[model samples]
Structures are given as C-alpha cells and as structure tokens.
Target: MQQCKLPSRQKGFSLIELMVGMTIGLILVAGLALMFANSSQSGNELEKSIRQIENGRYAVELLQEEISLAGYYAEIPLHGIAYSSPAACETSALGFSLTTLPMPIMGIAASNVSEICLTDRLANSPAFVIHRLSAEGAPSNPASAALGTTYVQSSRCSADGVPFKAATAGSASAFDLKAIDCATTNPQIRRYVSRVYYLASCSECGSVSDGIPTLKMAELRGTTMVVAPLVEGIENMVLEYGFDTNADGQPDVFQTNLSTTAGADKWDNVVAVRLHLLARTIDRSADYSDSSKTYQLGAASTVSGDASGFKRRVYTSTVRIVNEAGRRETVSYKPASSP
Candidate 1:
C-alpha cells in the first residue's frame, strides 16, 4: 500500500541535517587550530625565560669568582683610611691606598721597592706595571710625579723571570710583592704592601669613544687592563668597602668609592667588601611586555620607557678577605705567658 512510497524517505539527508553536520565539523577544526596556536606560543615563552635565567646566573657566577679573589694575594690593611697627604707633603694630592704581597716569596725584603706590576706575560709584550707609592693618597692626575713617590717598578716576568713592558704606560694601586716586614715595631704602619685593585666597568663600554664594553681591572700602580667580557648585559658595577674599625670589634667605615690618596686608612679596618652589580638582558623579547603575563623572575622590569622596551636586573654579593698572615700568626702564638 503506501508502503514503499513512504516517500522514498528522502533518500539523502535534509538540508538542515547537512548544515548541522558541517557546523559540528567546523567547530572541531577551529578548536584544534586554537589549541595548536596556544601550545606554540607557550613553548616560545618558556624558551625565552630559560635563556634569560641562564644569562643572569652566568653573570653572577663570573662576578663571584673575581670578587672572591679581591685582595687575593694580600689582605686589605684597614677597613677605611683617609687619603690625605703626609703633613710634610701637604701640597701633594691625596691618594687612596691598600696593600698585598707578591705571589712568589723570593726572600726579598718587602721594603725593597719593586714596582707593583701585573705580568700580562700570558698575553703578548707590554706587561702592566703597578707602582707602589709612598703617598697618603692618589693624585688627581697620576701622570704628575709630584703627587706621590714611585717606590718600585713592577715588571712582567715570564715563568723564567724575563721582564716585559706593558702596552700602556700606567700604574696599579694594588700589588703582589715578594715579602713584607711583618716584624716591624710600628703597629700603625702595615709591614706588608696592600695590593688593592678595584674591578669595575670603565667608560670604554657603551661609549662612542671606547668601542665595546669590557671588564677592566685598575690597580693603584696606575695600570688598567681590559680583561675579557665577564657578562654581556652588565650595565654598572659598584664596590663598597666595609671596615672593622676599633680593635673592639666589627667593621666601621662603609664607603662606596675607594680613595687613591688615602691608603687602607680610608677603610683600613675593612675586613669585608660589599659588591653590587647592575645587569641587563642583551636580547629583549616581545612576549615579556605583556602586562597580563608573568615570568619566573616576577613582573618584568623595563629599561627606560615603553619605547626602548629593555629589561634590567640587579644582583649583589659580599666577600671577606681573610687575613692569611693573621691566621698564621695566631696559629704560631699560643697566648704567650705573661713575662
């Protein structure tokens, strides 16, 4: 009867049915595309963060290595000492001072004036010379000999003792001497020369005049050497002196800058140093600017304005210059019986 004609049951799907099926398929495809896009973005961001962290960590390690070695060969004579010229040399410019002994003990009397120098013998000719001055402080112009006394002429020698000149003609405030008069009767004056060198960033970096930024180590002897780049993004480096004044205990003077005029006296009591470094990222990433997003380092700090879009980070560390001589002397003295 009406049997088969059941209206061919519309052999194919109705337009409405087809439209619904198509819509469902489109939704699934769109969702998959969105997921893939999100995954890719997340991966890129993760990679960028890891890189930044690695850079920062590397910089910190480098600084620690150098700073830990501050006054490495010798101990800081005092916490803080004013860079004032000797009363007799009043007209002379004041200078800061520190002391240290030579790496090798050749039995040379520390008194014998041997120029405090850095042997770049490892490098080519032109080794650096660090002159030990018998002055109260560093003169404004090191070139002027009137400011201080040129005690020793430090020369760069090979393992064989061959002397070499440094490329530049300058002096180093710090030094490594062969010997010091530890038995001196004068308690105020330190027998050993304090070789103090401040490792800081010079005007060379970021300056149109000085090609690229480099790590520089300056010594009281009037020598400056551009060492290898410790880290790329280092913006500024500062060193503070902490002194343990008064035999009673604890350091007293905390000065940001060291004076050439004043020997260790500026911080003669300084037993420790507080080092600070301001570093920035060499490569900036766009993802970091998003306000809604956060990184492992926390809220991203931009350079200057939104335009420059640079990021900066800072780190700090403190180091103590142990008195090797003091330790040794203490070990030698067993609280001698009152005579």
Candidate 2:
C-alpha cells in the first residue's frame, strides 16, 4: 500500500571504482611476480656455487694424492740409485723416471720460461710434475692381468724378486718364475706413473666459449702418455717447493722457481710442496660482477678478477711427502734444546 521511494539500486560498480580495483589487483600480481623471479635467480646462483666448490675440492684432492705419492717406488729408495746421466732415466711426454737429482717433484714458474720443468709450458701459469708407483700398489702377479694393470714382484718378502719383461699381450701371462735369476729377484716390477698437473686450453670443451677454465693432467696410460681433463672452472694453479737446504730434514726454504742447472743441487732437498688453485663459477652472475677484485693465492701470488660477471675462490694446501720425510729424520736438524 505504501509506495515508498526506495533508493535507486546501483546497477554495477562505477567506472572509477572498477578502474581502482583493477589497478590494485594488478599491483599485487606484479609484486608476486617480482618475488618469484628473485627467488628463482637466487636458487640458480646457489646451485652454481655448490657445483664449483665440489669440483674445486675434488680437483685438489686428486692432486694431493698424486703429489704425496711422488717419488715412491716400493721399498727401494729412489734417491739412492744414481744414473750416469739424466738420459739413462726413461722419459716421456707426461713423465720421466725419478732421478737422483730429485726429479720426482718438478715445477714450472709462472713468469720465467727458463725455470720450467715441462717441455711445453702454459703461459702465465705454474705447473707441477709427480712420479710414483701406481696406486694399485704392489700386487702379486695375476694368473692373467688386464692390459693396463700394474704389477710388482719384490724379494723384500722371501726370496729375490722376480724379473719380467715389459708387459705385452703375450708376456702379460707367461712369466716363468723358475727361469728368473736369484740376483734379479729383488727387482721392483710395478706400474710406473708420471703425471703433470696444469691448466689446459678449454676450447675443445664448452668452457672456453663460456669463459670457464679447466684443470688437466697428463698421465701414463699403458705405454702411452695421455692428457685428460680433471676438472672444470679451474682458472689458475701455483706451486712452491719447500727444501731442506741445511740437510736438517726440515724445510728451510720455499721457492716458486727452481732451475735444473742452477737449482739442481737443491732439487733432491725438496720435502714438501705448496699448492694454490683458483676456481670460478661456470655461469656469469646477472646481478653481481667480478671485475676489480684481486684474489691472493699465496704469500707472493695474487690474481686479478676479470670483467666477466662470475664468482671465484682460492684453495690452498701444504702437503709433506711422508715417504721422503720419514727417511730423512736421521739427518733432520733438531732444534737446540733451550734451557
């Protein structure tokens, strides 16, 4: 009955209200997108960092193991055996027989070409060489061994050691222990190892185009020496030798460069080695840059970061040759007793 004049029902939101609501919604969506993008980028960077660390640590351990084994030749003292000259020592691209001159551990200086031990040196980077008996250790001759397997026979146990000719397809299995002479029994017949660790050109791999570097080693494979990649993202390597110059059996001097002629006298005096490695991320950083950063590898070595946008780190270790040091304690200099 009462036709009350009700307020006109609003048909829909006004144009201005609709626009304001749309703008607010857009702003919220934009904020969420920005957060998600940042989180994804951070995750990618973390993954890269972890990969680099793993590779760097693995590479260093590989080198350390080999370096520690340098100069080890069963129980026989390699340094005690003297050759007529360096030529009598078997030589190869990757390795040479350890000589009396202490060639078990050799180095190439970064700056001086004349100080290099390796015939071909990598420019502006130092490298090191190591020689030792294979890690398989001295194994009794197998009934039939693989082509690359190393074996050892030593009289250190019972009778004189057995002597066998170089491994061949035919000779690998057919050695007559009865035919071997008693005087030749002590001969140490084991797989020999000569390895050179260095930074190598990565163009063959995908890294060079991507600005990444690689660590490589030349090791004896059968009768041939082959070079293979050890790790990626390694930028540089620096080495120093610690010498027992005073015959005290303790390191009295540490030097980066040693010449065969001038420093030949001190080569056999090497007791320990210092290793420095520079590692970098494989991918460039989108937000961060590496330019203008100088990394210190050791007391005397420092490398500047490039303009490329990548992160880097330095790894270092000082390793002592137990085989060498253990034998030298007889002549080791004991510090004078202080009252």
Candidate 3:
C-alpha cells in the first residue's frame, strides 16, 4: 500500500518545478532592487559632498577673518596726526576712513564695475572691501547714546572718529559734529566693521527660489547696510589682489583689476589675498558629470557657465595683509608728550 501512494506524491509542484521556482524568486528581487538603488545613490553623494565641504570651509574662514581685519584702525592715529577733525567712524554712512593708504583691501573683477571702495560694484561676480576697526566697546557715555546702538569715545586731546547712533543720542551738536571730542573724559568705545564679500543669487538655504549661490555680506549696521546671508553653496567669488608690487612688504604681482579710479595706488599695495572660492552642490547629480570639467578661477580666471549638474569645489586662499603686513617699523609721528 505504501509503495503505491509514494509515487503519487510528485504531483504537487512539477510545472518544470514551477518555472524554476519563479525564476529564482525574480532574481532575488532584482538583486535587492539594485543594491537599494546603489546605496541610495551613495548616500546622496555623501550628503552632497558634506554640504560642499562645509560651505567651502565656511566661506574660506569668513574671508580669512575679514581678511585679517583689513586695516583695523584701533590705535586711531594713522600716520602723522595734524587733523582738525573727521576720522569718520560710526558707520560713516559707508565712507569709512582712517586716512588713506589704509585702503585696507578692495576689489571688483568679473563684469568689471568701475567704482572701487564704497559699494556699487559686484555685478557679475568678484567683490571685496574690508576696512575694519571693531571689537572693542562697552565704555559708553556721552549721555548714554543708544539709538542704533551708540558707540563713541573721546578725551585725552581727541582726534576724531566714532560718531553714529543717531548722533550719539540726537544732538550734542550732532554728537560733536560726528565724534572725536566727546569730552566726557577718556571714554573709548568703538565699533565700525565694514565687510562686503559678494557672490549672490541669494540663498541662505531657501528663497530666491533656492537658486542657491549665496556668500553675500555687506554689514555696517549703524547708518545701515546690513546685507547678511553668509555661505550656502557659494557659487563663485574670484578676488586676486596680492600687490606690494615692489614696496617690499611681500606679495609681488597678482591683480584681477583694481578700482577707485584705477588701481588706487594698487590699494595700498595690498600685500596678499588671492582667494578663489567656487563651491557648489545644492543638489543635482544623478551620479556626477561636471561636463568635461574646467573650473579655473585664479590663473587668469575661467568658470563661465554650464557648471555640469552641481557638485563642485575650488576654494583657495593666499590671505596676509594682517593689518597691512603688521606695520610699525618706526612710524609713530606723535603721542610722546607725556611719559
């Protein structure tokens, strides 16, 4: 009886073994869906290349810390003294000054504007402008001026500079006619940092329809300039100065068009600052394709269009104008009358 029944057992799955077990379970489910779509496109291209190298090294360390604080005019006196007035701080409404040659950095190349220092260039790309003289306040006084956030200090003879905050609280004769002789004793407040650094199409990570290519700056605050939006796939920003064209302090050539009515004395012989930037990756990369690649920038410029399909990185830096090459090789023209 057992022998007869056993032969009938093969009647269950024999349609060629159910088509080879359904073609090996549909080829192991299409090889696990192509290895989970290539590991989710390599984890979205390593998280968009680590957010484009952390937004291009935080926009090249925030323009190398504002280009080493360009011409930080803190000690105040900038060469020979004889001033009757006007060192002009307190957001000089953008006319900043420590008295010439402290040009403290400036640029414009790439659609070549024409104007140099005080805003208005930045057309197709490249930009700069630093100035400096901030980070040192709190002393306050002059009737506690505080309109746009007061800042002024004078006494000890005074030379001028530090007048903004709605004329140090609306009229002390317009804050001693724009700072410097506040006479409230040795007060000493300070705050005036000019910035600039361009490259915009707007994008702090949203808005402007996310065309993403930010990096913008501006900043002044008092009389108001304020731009903001820093770093976000910073698409481009050339800037090449370098200069010292022979005054010695270092740096020899590198230009990229200067301004303020042409080379404005090569912007105090710049001293150093090459920076290139470029950075990109605001998404868009089916698996990469910088279209034959090019991306030049500093060696006389490049990067024109069709930036492939995202994912880029250039970032460079030369930076060194540390307070104009850390000056003071014996130049103090005054202040010795009281030891």
Candidate 4:
C-alpha cells in the first residue's frame, strides 16, 4: 500500500523548475551571441590594421629606393658629374681636370683649359641622363682618337622617356641642349640633381585623375609628369632635410622648409634627407573612443568627421639618401695635371 502511494509523485515539472531551466538555456544562448559579436568585431579590426601596415611599408620602400638614388649617375666618367658644381674658386683640381673638353671626344681638351663644366642629364628631364668623359689621359693620334674618341651624346634610356621640363626658373625645354666643359674648379663643379617628392590623397581606393592621382610634388626638377601610386590610403607626405654642417659624419640641421631664406642658403647643404609620411584608413568600423583603451597613433586624440566612433591609425618612417652624389668626393673632380 505504501509503495503504491509513493508512486503518485509529480508526473510533470513544476512551474518554478520549468522557469529555472528556461532561464539557464536563455543565458547560454545570450553568452554565445555575445562571443560571436566580439569575434567578428576583432576580425574586422585586425584586417584594418594589416592593411594600414602594408600601405605604410610599401610607401617607405618606394621612398627609400628613390632617396637612396638621389644622386645616381651612370658609372661612366662623364656621367659622374655632381649635381651642384662648386664655386669657381673652391672647385677641386681633380674635378676641374675631369671636366676638360667635350665628353668622350679625344683631342677635345686643349692645354689652355683649366677645368670642365657639364650639365646633369637628369637635371631637367623626367628621368636621368649620363654626360661623361671617356677616360683620363692625353688625346691619342688620329686612328686612336677614333678608337678612343668618346663623343658628347645622349645615353640610352633607362626609364620611361616622357619629356619633362625642369621646374627651375628657366625657359629651357625638355630636350634643350646642355653643355659640359673641362674647366672650372669649385664645389659648384657638381651637377645639381634636383629631387622630386610628392603626396597624394584619394577618397576612393582606385580612382585616378588625368592618369595622375591627386598628388602634390615638392622640388620638382623635371616636367609635371604623372607619378605612380606608392600605396592606397596615403593621405599626406612631408620632407625634412638633415645637414652635416660640421662634416662630423653626422646630421646637424633639421629643416621643414627647403626653400631659400633671406640670408640662409636653401637646402643646398643638405647631405642627407629624412622623409615622413602620414597614412590613414579609408574605412574604420571599430568603436575606438573607449577612454579606457589605447591604439596606434596614441590615445585617440579628437575623433574626426564621421570617424568619431571608428578607429584611426598613422605610421611614420625615416630614410637617408644612400646614393647621394654630393657625398662622393672621390669622383667629384679630376686631377689638375690629368687634363
């Protein structure tokens, strides 16, 4: 009888029990949803950061390549002229001798000549040119002259042959005739190879204008030719020059303005260059305004435009001019007696 009564226990779950079970299930579902949302947000941020880093790295690489080759001339003698010639007095005897006569032509240099002058091939052209002497020695006889006779002529094209005019305050055309004479002994003996630096801004990823993106170039030496895009989302670029004034083998001066001042020389004394770039993301999705958290570019300073709720990133790099011609004293001038 007692066993039969015990068997009459509850056949269905009570309301309290049912409510407890349902609450537990709801909590689990909510936790899973929260985790998925967090994961998705994290993935998006990671992608954006990766893209920013890649763009920055690409820009730095391009700038480094060009800057390092700031004074790149062909290995040939005539082509090795400095971009900026020393003053007539300071010109080295070696440099003066190296500049003798028209390049490559034997017997071109007469004993009367004390120095030589040559224009930079890349000075006013969109690309570089090589104006050089054949070698160092006395002019050979007629037959040898023909064999050793180096002539002043245009070198082969190594880059796109787009015609470009120099940005200097001169009326010279892109293909104007420039001469080199084997005379003059001054620091100005070097050919002044101008550097072209620029910045481009784009709202869309791939939009280009007039075959040129929206970019601004500083110290443009040649024609206003279109520049290739280094990377996407590059907003602005600025340049600074470092001068080794004391010749202590280290940079001493830092300048943002490259233009000449009233009394001070322009960046002509600059032996090394430092480049800085500012890049940003086209689209940001993360809520980056959290006061308790920090990200790249320091604690989010004032958010901008619709980006108040999204992430913002910036990158910077510095590169020295490795191939600077002005730094080459050995090849700057020819010996006095060599002429």
- lDDT tens digits by residue: candidate 1, 189-226: 12112232222233344334332222333333222222
Residue lDDT tens for model 2, 1-339: 889898997798889999999999999999999999999998999999999999889988988887788777564434445422221123433222233322567665566555332333346776766766665744444454546543433334334232223233235333333323543333345565667677764624442353347887766566555667778888888777888766556777777766655352456667888888998888888767776789988788889987677889999998887666666777448899999
TM-score of each: 0.44, 0.76, 0.36, 0.48
**Best candidate per TM-score, number?**
2
Least accurate stretch of 10 residues (summed lDDT) in model 1? 120-129
Compared with the true structure, all predictions reach lDDT values of: 0.37, 0.64, 0.63, 0.38
- Encode model 3's per-residue lDDT on 1-339: one tens digit a residue: 455544544458879999999999999999999999999989988999998999899889878877877876565545552112112222454443233322566665556555333232234876766765565455455555556643433324434443222233455553442233444444444554556667766464343256677777766665666676777777777777777644547777777776534342456667678888889888788646776777887988887546457878788888887767666233447767875
Q: The CA-based lDDT of model 3 is what?
A: 0.63
Off by over 4 Å in 4: 1-20, 76-197, 203-224, 244-250, 260-264, 290-314, 329-339
Between the candidate structures 1 and 2, which one is better when assessed by lDDT? 2
Ranking by TM-score: 2, 4, 1, 3
The lDDT, on a scale of 0 to 1, for candidate 2 is: 0.64
State in Å the error of residue 81, model 2: 1.7
Q: Return whichever of 3 and 4 wins on TM-score.
A: 4
- Candidate 3: give the clashing pairs: none
Model 1, residue 301: displacement in angstroms?
A: 16
